[model samples]
Target chain A: MMKATVYVTIKQGVLDPQGVAVQGALHSMGFEEVSSLRIGKYMELQLDTNDRAEAEQRVKAMCEKLLANTVVEDYRYELEG
Target chain B: MMKATVYVTIKQGVLDPQGVAVQGALHSMGFEEVSSLRIGKYMELQLDTNDRAEAEQRVKAMCEKLLANTVVEDYRYELEG
Candidate 1:
């Protein structure tokens, strides 16, 4: 089986309200040293395949189709056995 | 200087439309081998501080305040020199 880890994030220019809210909460929790924070998503998948080429092809398709939003998000993945 | 890397993702049971769309795209691209895909975000921050405790406090605050949405997102971060 092949395992893949994917990371996704919003584009820099977009506004992130969620990040702002978390920063505020941290400050209230006696963590006043914080400056800024941004949030993203992570995913892990296990595939039943051994071919690297096939894995890449499928992963790339996955990223382009459902793993990432081309309009506001970018995604990358790492594959391992 | 303190550098931190933050990762954020949608909690399980949350709907990820972006992830779903990417999956569809990948399938069309001849990557039918993929079973599932989830998307998330990654962030790298450069801070001007050296104290580990202080850094942690600040980073944690950032995560809680703005880096993540407690309702729908989860976050984690790493600290480095």
Candidate 2:
């Protein structure tokens, strides 16, 4: 089996309200040293195939078509077997 | 300045509804090669201080106190300056 780890994050210049809220909550909890925070998504997938190239291609297609909003978010993935 | 990347994932045995929904969507989209999928949270933090040890300590505390729900999620972080 092949395993893929994908990260999906908002593009720069995007306003992340959830991140802002979490930062505020942290500060309120007295974690004053936190300067900035951004929150994103992490996904793990297990694929049946062992072909690295095929896995990579399929994973990329998955990210583009369903896992990420390419216009507002950027995604990168790592694969391992 | 320092940057920290934190990954928060649902603990084993925990049911992840969002992950299930995404997996279902992927299968519907014909990515049937995907055997399993899990989703979690990714966070980036920029801190004002550069001390590696202090940063690690603070980040750990932040994760335990705010960034993750220890009851259902486990968090790990990497730091860079």
Candidate 3:
């Protein structure tokens, strides 16, 4: 089996309210050294096949089709078996 | 300056409703090659300091105290300067 780990992050210019909230919370908790924080989504997929090239293609397609909002987010993935 | 990328994933045996929903959506969209999917959180931190060791320490503390729910999630981070 092959395991794919995908990271989906908001585009640089996009507004991230959840990230802002988390940063505020961190500062309030006395972690004031944090300059900025941006939050996104992480996903892991376990595939039954072991073809690395095919896995990458499928995962990329999956990201574009369902895992991420391409207009506002960008995705990258790592594959391992 | 240093940038940290943190990945927070659901612990094994923990329930992930969001992941389940996404997997179902993928199946509906005909990406049936996916056997299992787990969704988590990804965070990026931009710090004003350039100390690699310090960045790792602070980011780990941040993850433990705020970024991740240790009871149900596990976190790992990579630092780049």
In order, the interface RMSDs are 3.4, 0.6, 1.1
Score residue B3 of candidate 1 by CA lDDT: 77
lDDT of 3 by residue, A1-81 (tens): 899999999999999999999989988987777788999998999987878898898899999988889999999999998
Which prediction has the highest lDDT against the true structure? Answer: 2
Q: Write the per-residue lDDT of candidate 1 for residues B1-81, one digit (tens) a residue.
A: 787998877888998787777666666876666676666667766666888888887778776876678799888889998
Rank candidates by TM-score, best first: 2, 3, 1
Over A1-81, each residue of candidate 2 has an lDDT whose tens digit, in order, gives 999999999999999899999999989988877888999999999999999999999999999999999999999999998
Best model number under TM-score: 2
Residue B70, model 3: Cα distance from true site in angstroms: 0.6
Per-residue accuracy of model 1 over A1-81 as CA lDDT, tens digit each? 798997777788887787677667766876555576666667777677998888877777776876678798877789898
Per-residue alpha-carbon lDDT of model 2 for B1-81, expressed as tens digits? Answer: 999999999999999999999999999999998988999999999888978998899899999988899999999999998
lDDT of 2 at A24: 96
lDDT of 3: 0.90
> RMSD, each candidate, Å?
4.4, 0.7, 1.4
